[model samples]
Target: MKATIRWAGDVKFEAESGSGHTVTIDGPPDHGGKNQGVRPMELMLLGVGGCSSFDVMHILKKSRQDVTGCVAEVEAERVDEVPAVFKSIHLHFIVTGRALKEAQVKRAVELSAEKYCSASIMLGKAGVDITHSYEIHEAAE
Candidate 1:
């Protein structure tokens, strides 16, 4: 619910979440940064993937799906302007399981995108052109 960001040096910042977790945000050397950590924009996009992945896993578990692994791969585009804000973002989920029902997997993804994932939903509401897609793979024996 709360967080703080402090300057760690030139073009670098450290963010501490309310839960006491910390992460470093830095830019490329061309931007006067040492490139010691993730960029702020990358972190923001990752947050959306994390939020959506959490929701999908939770829903699948609740439904008793035999989940083996899950990965949310994120991609984005930024406008070619001074601010360079995100213009669109896409999430491609690769879900693995044993005998995973296609309908259930589809439903889980839809639920996360439409109802549960707060980060993506918030960005969507802010006109960020958010989109989602998914593929299911059976676990290896």
Candidate 2:
């Protein structure tokens, strides 16, 4: 519910969450950063991906799906003018499992986007054109 961002010099910062987790954030060299860590915007996108992926995996596991691996690829567009912000974002989930049910996969994705994944919901409410799609890969029997 709370976090802190402390400057670590030259456009770099250390962000810590209330739960004691921390991550480094920095800008590109052109913006005076040393490129030591992920960009702020990149972190935002990553957060959303992580959030949704977590939900999907949890839901699938609860359904007794033999989940093997999962990956989320996210793409976003930003405004061209000053104070640039994300205008749209798309998430593609690639889920791998043994005999994974297509309907279950679809339902998991839907549950995350519509019921869970607070990050995506918040961004969507902010007018970001957030969209989701998914592919399911069955593992070799």
TM-score of each: 0.97, 0.96
Per-residue lDDT of 101 in model 1? 93
Error of 2 at 107 (Å): 0.6
> Whole-model Cα lDDT per candidate?
0.94, 0.95
What is the alpha-carbon lDDT of model 2 when measured against the actual structure? 0.95
Candidate 1 lDDT by residue in tens digits, 1-141: 999999999999999999999999999999999999999899999999999999999999999999999999999999999888889999999999999998999999999999999999998998899988999999999
Candidate 2: where are CA atoms >4 Å away? none
Best-performing candidate as measured by TM-score: 1
Tell me the TM-score of model 2. 0.96
- For candidate 2, the per-residue lDDT at 126 reads 92
**What does candidate 1 score on TM?**
0.97
